[model samples]
Target: MLCIYNLQLTQTHHFFHSKKGVPFADYQGICNWLTRLVQIENGKQLTCNRNFIAPLCELCCASSLQIGSLMHAFDSVKSALRVLEESVALNCEEETTKSCIQYLEAVPWDDSEEEEIVKVASRLGPIAMPIVARISPVDLTATRNVFLSALRFATSSPGGEGSGLPFGDELRTSAQEQIEYMLGEDEETPLVTADDEVRSVARAGLAQIFSSFQTIISCSLSETTETEALHIVSDLVWMCNVLPKMDMMKDFVVRWTEASIVEIIEDNRFESIVWGLKVKVIEVTVKVLEAVGYGTVILQPTLRVQLLRTWLPYIRKLKPILDAKAEQDPSFGHRMDEDLCQNIEGAIVSLILALPSNDQGEILAGWMSGEQVKFPDLSEAFEVWCYRTKSAKRRLVEGGLDRVGNGNGRIETTEMRDMTMIPSAMVLIADTDRKESLAVKGSRK
Candidate 1:
């Protein structure tokens, strides 16, 4: 009995001190060491080699099933976050900073573990949101970004888990507010300085957030939300303005323009701000025109029609506004000082010209005759018919007046000709009238 008890004691001692003398370890053994490390009295004493931890994480994330076995991974990560938080709080020594980084390194780049980190960080987002929020280092932008990226990845992946156990719908709106907080409020001004994969991933996450704003703008019921929706639209436009411009991304611009036209302007709610709103429309119109002229193809024909269709009615309305206002001011409404008129005219002309040339005259003619066609304002239509008549006359003069010729090649030779010369006939009639008047005056004399 004494011999058996002594053997058991020796075995237990050997098991507890197994890692004391080992210089390096196999991957599986490192996890067991990590599991045991958490239980140690002085957990910080065991030096964590990032080299071993990182590789082990890579191997674990590569297997989907291993995630279930590593559920307690968050404990170590939470401890690391605590160290990081405290360091930031104390603004401690450089050595403490080094130790904080070491702790982070040991947390592993595994997707599952990274996801767990995100779960903890999400609570910080809305909780940290304060009244009259301001962007600053204290906002913890980097950590927020890291958490967001991980959260998005895990949620979107085919079989990854995240903060909201089975699934989360609020992720979109929540993520949107968090990012918009950083972007709009200027918290830490997250710079783009990473490789393509990282940068693309980040941009995609941001786009998703903005997409939520698009939804709100679409579904908003109240005037206040509608106005707020416009502000959000402005934020999105600002984002597009600041980012690297791409041809493919013009759809968002189109959507934004559509929303502006339908939601804000069409209802005519803000009548006082019509001019400002019109100016915005004009700017977007110019962009669309340039895109069309340059042969940038946006797939939505309805969007093209929606934007183009607004032009004529808007222009005609502007004519009345200019005329009414001009009646009030002599200098300000000087006929030649028609900047708005010119812009509207130029936009219509460019848009028409951009369409096939044949379409221009036809649509213009319809517009002139009040045919209610898909294009051309009444002014444009009248211009078209007048130009067509003058063009025909010019052709008749250039090619003998006996007949008019067209691209069809030949005019009929048998066409009727005028018996009297127009100029000669007019002169003869005038002379006869003068002679008769002279005869009558002589008789009176």
Candidate 2:
């Protein structure tokens, strides 16, 4: 009926344009021709023929600037923009697309002119977002290339400043919504790997998106913007391989803390981001312990007593991993069993020998009376114990130290002549705070 006749009329319009030397009287006539031609079902095929689209391209390109300017006279910039959008859409090849973008970019902008484009782009953002999602996976490499180029041009071009228009915001949000939709796909989906050109494009796109997130977090205006920025940061942090490069992320962790970010990393959500982040808690703890010795921090005797009585049970769970190499090699395991205790005893012997002989009684009395006993030398003493234990393990494996069989599952070593060595290591570490207290008291006196 009417629909079939209208379709035939559209095809006839395409046939008219496809022929060479077919000329329209003017730009209005050219637009009218294109309007009829666009209604053709095989318009893409006709346009692909090059000759068919020559008149339309001539209209879109040759008079693009004048038509854009004329667009305001009829209050028809909307139609101009639509035609430009359509002209680019029909010629889906790279060179044509580039020419189309160049023409649009070259369009003259005044306060009123740019405002209209920003309004249209903003209204189009949500519609473009869903379209990108639906079609991304089928041809990710091609889609990503186009998207990356568009975003680059959107974010980098300079214009529309002080024009009472929010073109920058509209362009940024619209382009970002499209990029985010592609990246938000399920993990199981296979990513497109077309060729070197395509991957290079994808990498550049991901880097730009990641940089945008970083810029947002570091430079955002307010709390709400920062929160949105954090969401973006969280996404990149989880998706990328970031763990090995710890220092690069320190500022991000500090920002998270300052921003009062308290969310625990869930098992699945942002798993990559979480796994990639350097362990902030462990890094902070080690730094604090180094600057302020063990006893002055969490290991102060009052806390140490509680921690040993309570937390040691938890810490023991980690011992197997720490002790893995010692047990794996039986020769080494046997040597550790034979010499560890005596090696520890030798360190204590050297330390006790160096102490003022008469002060030994005072030290003993302090310990016996339950007074605050000081271990000024505990740090060096602890280092020696660790070294000796590791060395003994190595020596047993090397057949340098003898081992005695013990039925218990625990690796039993030969008994030291001085059994006090084991308990003294703990005592020295626990008593380090008392030495600082004594120094403070002496200074006051």
Candidate 3:
């Protein structure tokens, strides 16, 4: 039976790779053939032998398959996964799940194999996670490792040179576009077309994979040390930063805010965390706030207040280090310190801008009046807020709202004039960075 199966598999491989070049007809044919083989292997007559399963597993593990073949290959693997899931349910066969995991684990993790790995994980993860969860701890850990590895593979940079690809930003934008399109409601077309249905399914599947990835990250954080947890927290924040765009995953934001963000902000060990880690956390937090603003997701007022309270101290702590570094080396390297300060201020500005207008005033007042406020970034932020408020007030005046009462029987001019007219600190920061880059390049030349 094993020899016959191998021969058939080889023949199928040849059929798909023929010079005719994978006709559309071959997709269903391959799927049916693989489905039938799985049925026979899982049938009562075959005694559910492990040897019979090895050939089928090998077929799934054939990562060398071309793109034309991968579609059918993944379909077949999905079928095999179903068969294993059924066997585990009916016969209590833990070995079947283990074997499936082992085959998935064997998939290569280099550039050549990335797309296949992504396809497999995106398909198999949702199916495999449930079964893996029910099995032993060893199996769970093994499966988690494989899933995390595949996730890192999928999201990481293609050539593996830098931090992971900006998948979070891409996925967030895609989700936002989809949501906007769906919400437009401009048409009431009768029947949903096949393409629309397929896209809907795809979105749902992607959401599931995202949730699984979050769970894996959260679980990893629970088991790791503080340093490891910091790394995981960075990933968590990165993921959370993008998640707000997907309305379906709003719960993730709540989970992150309550579980991780609060702890990181409130923890007394803030002084002990290294500078790089601190930067990562702050950057990701800023990203999360920006995502919130773009999506217009309304965070709880208390949470907003807590974010400001916690971030202020960190920004204060960061300033001395940055100032000290500038004093020590006021050269090209000082550009980095300036950049960090700019980023920290950018985050503060974003956070403040995300607040309601009334709340923004309160937050700005506290920051500008605080005795501990030593960073120039705070003043920069204050200037940006003043400029924005001035813009808003000007718009109101142009719109003829100047005559409107403040609901307190007084004009609003007194409040608007008190705000200063400084240039946008963000644009100034950008121009400075550009000039610095050009100067550095010229010096090097």
Per-residue C-alpha lDDT of model 2 across residues 317-432, encoded as one tens digit per residue: 22232245447754432122223323333433233322222223333343335322222223333433334344545655576334653454323346421222333443463355
| Comparing 1 and 3 on TM-score, the stronger one | 3
For each candidate, the alpha-carbon lDDT, in order, equals: 0.43, 0.38, 0.47
Candidate 1: what lDDT?
0.43
Candidates in order, TM-scores: namely 0.32, 0.20, 0.37
In candidate 2, which residue ranges exceed 4 Å CA deviation?
Answer: 1-146, 150-165, 186-189, 193-195, 202-445
lDDT of 1 by residue, 133-193 (tens): 3222344556555645743552242222343654442453355345444444243444322
Weakest 10 consecutive residues of candidate 3 by summed lDDT: 185-194
Clash pairs for candidate 1: 364-381
Over 4 Å off in model 3, which ranges?
1-224, 237-270, 273-277, 293-306, 319-340, 354-357, 371-381, 384-398, 402-445
Rank order by lDDT, top first?
3, 1, 2
Kindly indicate the candidate among 2 and 3 with the higher lDDT: 3
